[model samples]
Target: MYLFLVLSLHTLWVAVSIAMQHGHYDMCKTQTKSDEGIVWEYMACQPESRDMTPYLKVKLEPPNSTCGDPPEPFCAMGNPYMCNNECDASTKELAHPPELMFDSEGRNPSTFWQSVTWKNYPAPLQINVTLSWGKTIELTQNIAITFESGRPEKMILEKSLDYGLTWQPYQFYAADCLDAFRMEPKSVKDLTSSTVLDIICTEEYSTGYATHTKTISFEIKDRFAIFAGPRLHNMASLYSQLDTTKNLRDFFTVTDLRIRLLKPATGATFVDERNLERYFYAISDIKIHGRCKCNLHANSCTFTNNRLACDCEHNTTGQDCERCKKNYQGQAWSPGSYLTIPKGTANICVSSMPSNCYCYGHSNRCTYIEVVNTAVCVGCRHNTHGQQCEKCKKGFHRNGSAKLDDVNVCIANICDNELLRCQNGGVCHNNMRCLCPSGYTGILCEKQKCEDTGSCSSKSGQESVSHNLYLITMIIVTRLCTF
Candidate 1:
């Protein structure tokens, strides 16, 4: 009996030893350390341990690394090109290598499908960012970025519809591209078997990522569907993880802020010199990445300001509540936190509603939220009613002060309510659609003035959208009382 027991023990020991070996092999040794000993030895090396770091918040550095304080490779005075373009003593146009956000705030120790976003960075003459997550079948949702590219010509957006396999032309014009790539809310496609949405710009050079921006952007929805755009991401899985050293929320850099520059150069080939200068993204600035390893069922974690301190909680991740985490930040079991605005006061404060809420002031506030799905300042007050949240009470006019709260209650009919309407020559159409005669288009016709800016938003032939169709199309037409 003793000999039989000893044999059984030996067999059990062998099985346990083999199990530990296989377990270590299966463990993701990519970022973590490995050791050996007992059956439960491998279990001690959890991926979360390697995920440790002290990076949380950080300065939102400019998109291009050249924006550092001193400004690299200084030259003699009076040299505009050297001072601005990172050029050497002479005028040289070296690509403003972007700043990669590498730190603890970007590493992924636990969870999946996590992503980051930056909002404080204002638009410039030219701007671009590249990112990728998960494997071939991992990239799902779309991303969009709204920028002010200095020049009034248009925006340039380049993307990779495939897994960094091919390329498409860069897109110009934010209005047009945004109008096209604006994703349908909660769209569900066969991401696993068929084509997944790839409308985002992932600027990976190793995968032959030529400047596809040279080509004209493709038709909206179709461009991001299944097979177009610039292919930047080579491997799918490699795109999803984070760097344990940099801030997670700001993983990419903005190389081109060219508001001062003129028209985006139009060339024939896809190269740096031939690179298109302008852009708008399919998923402008707002990118949400998830994990491909786990069954698409959990929230991805994220780091704010270079700090990995924040958990996605079930199925939530990103500077905003983009992709959720497992159980806590991503899982349906938990509601998880909502997507947060990337940086400082983004003209959009969601929670602070009713009182200083801009929605109370602007009619387009809700629409603005929808376009970007972020917070917005309504700028409304007690004496305001119109969309711009600028006006006097029903009975009281501007009362000398046309400001939101700077008006007074009317004692009687101080003046004709009709004559002194929008003083700046804007058509005093009811509800303050505030169209400035003919050459105006803005929240309050604060731009220029004109006679008849065609009518749109109504579809009634002559109906215009307060053209020349740049940003806001708030215009109210009124009948001229000709005698």
Candidate 2:
């Protein structure tokens, strides 16, 4: 089902192939000032001009290595040129390299199928993604990549403090890829037969990862086709379980966060359906988790226990004061949190009021009970509960949520009524299905079960051969007497 959804999207992408031809690095032009602190607009909103030189754009340095013949490295269209005539058809393959998948554009979700491919191994495929935020994100939480499949491969994550000029592996501690096996043990239970692996840095190893660099780099190692398994995972799982050490601002300060994907100088090659061996690596998505980037006004701004400890006003709260505290809600602005506005003396709670308890079909019958610090409506009318007399009670089933202006009343679960209702105080469910009492058995709880003979054993109990033989003999004798 998941594969079908992905393929369907791929087919729809062909119509917009024109916009995807340009590589991201060389695609957008600056419409206004290119200041470091300037707020960056979406690429589509940026002015389009073909005359902008490559040096004028803000782009990461391209990988020193790529596939194809030597003397001049080959890169996808709209990328930096290492030498003259870089993107000339005569010097490069006739087909353009696949575009790398990254940020989402308006109206469309992030394009997942776009990728960078090479007819031959591109040593290591390196992609540098820039990170931008209004207020600095104090914690570097986690990083995860979704690949084409869960295949046996290795990628070294690196970071660069001084932009992409230099890079080093994230070496706070040795990362044990095996830790991921715990989360999805079923996938890699038999490592020999495993095809996908979601590698997560265990809690013990994530301790000071962000202190090393600002740029995140992935160096994927090639695995043989005989043991190919493509894997994908969420980015949050890569962070340290301890929130204190996972703060991003504790490390170096950077204006741009770049992610570089480097394909090895040499790696595995596979024969395509065309019977051609091609060296290609692809990624579907990259996700980063961290606190919101909003400037907040609080009584104090400080880090407490690795969290942004802020004594927000009654109207505001959240990592960056980005949300209104419960009971105070309105449209967001400025600091981004919803507020009651005009000095914050209004009660605009998001939750429904805790008023008189009501159950479905009865407005004044149900009573409220405190359970686990919350009020619960019990003994509701029509076997329902809720502050608004909505929702079915326990042991009842609801097909779906009640529509607006609809009363959500639950019907009784009575066992077969026309036939024998459960005998001996048995419970009824599913209209006629009876839940028999102990010391009794049969469809309607009509038969007395002998405890000594284990006749009341659960249905899953192993039946003795003697019992089966006795039952058969009784049936045979009854049939002979009738004959």
> How does each model score on TM-score?
0.19, 0.25
Q: Which window of 10 residues has the lowest lDDT sum in candidate 2?
A: 44-53
User: What overall lDDT goes with each candidate model?
Assistant: 0.29, 0.35
lDDT of 1 by residue, 165-204 (tens): 5444333343223343452322223222132323332211
**Would you give me the overall lDDT of model 2?**
0.35
Model number with the top TM-score:
2
**In lDDT terms, which candidate is top?**
2
- The Cα error of candidate 1 at residue 245, in Å, is 40
As a TM-score, model 1 comes out at: 0.19
